[model samples]
Target chain A: MTVPPGRRERKKAATRQKIAGTALRLFLERGYDAVGIREVAAEADVAVTTLFSHFASKEALVFEQDEDFEQRLTQAVTGRAPHEPLIPALRREIQALVRHCTADSAAPIWRMIDESPALRKYEESMRLRHAETLATAIAADPELSQTATASRTIARFVIDAYSLAREAADPEAAVDEIFRMIEAAWEVTCPSRRA
Target chain B: MTVPPGRRERKKAATRQKIAGTALRLFLERGYDAVGIREVAAEADVAVTTLFSHFASKEALVFEQDEDFEQRLTQAVTGRAPHEPLIPALRREIQALVRHCTADSAAPIWRMIDESPALRKYEESMRLRHAETLATAIAADPELSQTATASRTIARFVIDAYSLAREAADPEAAVDEIFRMIEAAWEVTCPSRRA
Candidate 1:
């Protein structure tokens, strides 16, 4: 059982959401490069220091769900049903993520990211970090019995599936195609588990 | 047959090499972020415009071999001996690249890159571009006859092998191990080619 957040925690969450929502609106309205942090803070009714407290940098504001995204990926490995196969779990998660990102609502945000070098660079490094975290989670699973290199490689391949699928003409089909490859790659690492 | 360059081209090539060497030496000594473009041009005894012509950005100075690297990856696909298998050819090229980047002489340059977020981001994007070129080469090959998605997925896996191997404790072994997985992944896309 989980304890619900206290009042203080709830207020902090509200503040962060407001800041992020305001920043995204400003960025989309005028252009990511045109907007300034001070302007975002002013418009959000938060101090510059408060904005910094919430997000590490302007790039961080644009990727407000960075931590959440990382956590979901890791959890998809660690929190799956007992005896659930790893590749399928990851495939489901990636499919959902591709759906979320490719939804019509997210098009403008991704367009902004593709157009701006700063955002693209930031997203690249962010994905690398997520891949590393996922690697650690995969390595820690005793049931998988994969070598360190295998674990890391599969993690990167899964992350690549997400990235590649997002850009494909048919994101869902791309995920399925890529996961079929990943499933084969994973089975090779554990010959005993081959069906 | 390849023809030798004329005098004008030879002179241009020499100037480009000199500028790259000078900039690298300075970056290694004084640090990549601390050195200015003007300082590098002055030290190389070329105008700022000439330096810019040779390298598009300061990050480009550190990665002078970027174009060469991209070309070599694509060539590994396009220029392989007739009837040579695809996975092993890519494995050999990636093995060579990992060796080049992991050499003692290349340690300091990679260290500098790891220390700077900007350089890490630049390298990430550069690798993406190389992956796309590789995918295109693979898709254009009549013998492979892979779906565009499979070609692209395998291209990313090959690039990931290079990157993950570079950071591994035993880069050569890492390359071999990762390629085993890639070989399996590739075979699944071309079931007819499976042994």
Candidate 2:
């Protein structure tokens, strides 16, 4: 039951995509450090203010999917099928994210991020923000019955799983292995779930 | 057996301490962002090169104990009492660290770190590096016999405990609560420990 975006919204979305695509192309061609926001805006045929309006900073441009990534994580908790276990839902989402980022097409962008101190720092703080958002969503679910501490702890662990799996030699296997540990951790918080 | 440092080594240590103390004072007096590296060196009465030699960056001065922190975590694993369970040993170490950072004396330093984006990012990366070193120490213990993934996952959970607890309302209690989850996570990886 969602309304379709009107023309104005559609145009704005298109502009954002074009700017992000153009910025990524320029960053990859030249070094991230070498490229300026002005250059990105000029090459994208947008004003400097327009670029800033869409993205908060140069680092934000590189992490074009930051908001989407955060939303997906929280939704995995809030949008799961009723009574389905929490850790598995989170594991499935993390597995998908690891796959998306580790795909061959995404290699160059990650390499560029790893090489830039600015980008790496931005990504770390971005992950912390996502973890906090996920914690809030988890705490809001009455059925989960987690204490504030438990909710925050589980959220951080889920975020850690995604990050650690992404860097592992085998991302899929790493997700399963880490999720087993998370499942055990989660279950310990539920005394009723134990024999 | 431990030997005291020679005079030259003692002098080098004193110089390093003076530079770090001076830098921290300036960073606190002026905002971290307002203070510059050259100003720190000048105030400390060291050549710019001498300051650079002792500390890698402005951020490094803020985290002067980074190496010591990493070493202590690794030593918690590699130098534990024989037959001591891994999770408890790590829990003890993490508790100590949380207490150290949460002390009233350390509040200003941590406040400075939280207020500065550069310092926060630096701390995140430093935590990751410490986790890796702890993982290596855990994996190398023949008695533990964990897979590489398990060792790494546990290492991250321990590091997360320290961080989450440091920010919690009751830091000491948070450390204990998170360690309970970590203990459960670690036990799952050790099939032999269960009936």
Each prediction's Cα lDDT score? 0.92, 0.91
Give the least accurate 10-residue stretch of model 2 chain B, judged by summed lDDT: B186-195
Q: Which digits, one per residue and each the tens of the lDDT, describe model 2 over residues A9-35?
A: 989999999999999999999999999
RMSD of each candidate relative to the true structure: 2.7, 2.8
Give the clash count for model 2: 0
Model 1 global lDDT (CA atoms, 0 to 1): 0.92
Q: What is the TM-score of each candidate against the true structure?
A: 0.91, 0.91
Model 1 CA deviation exceeding 4 Å by range: A1-15, A45-50, B1-11, B47-50
Candidate 1 residue lDDT tens string, A1-195: 259888889899999999999999999999999999999999999999999998988999899988899999999999999889999999999999999999999999999999998898889889989999999999999778888899999999999999999999999999999999999898888846534
Q: Against the native chain B, what TM-score does each candidate's chain B reach?
A: 0.93, 0.94
Candidate 2 per-residue C-alpha lDDT over B75-117 given as tens digits, one digit per residue, 9 for 90 to 100? 9998999888888898888889889999999999999999998
Looking at model 1 chain B, which ten-residue stretch has the lowest summed lDDT? B186-195
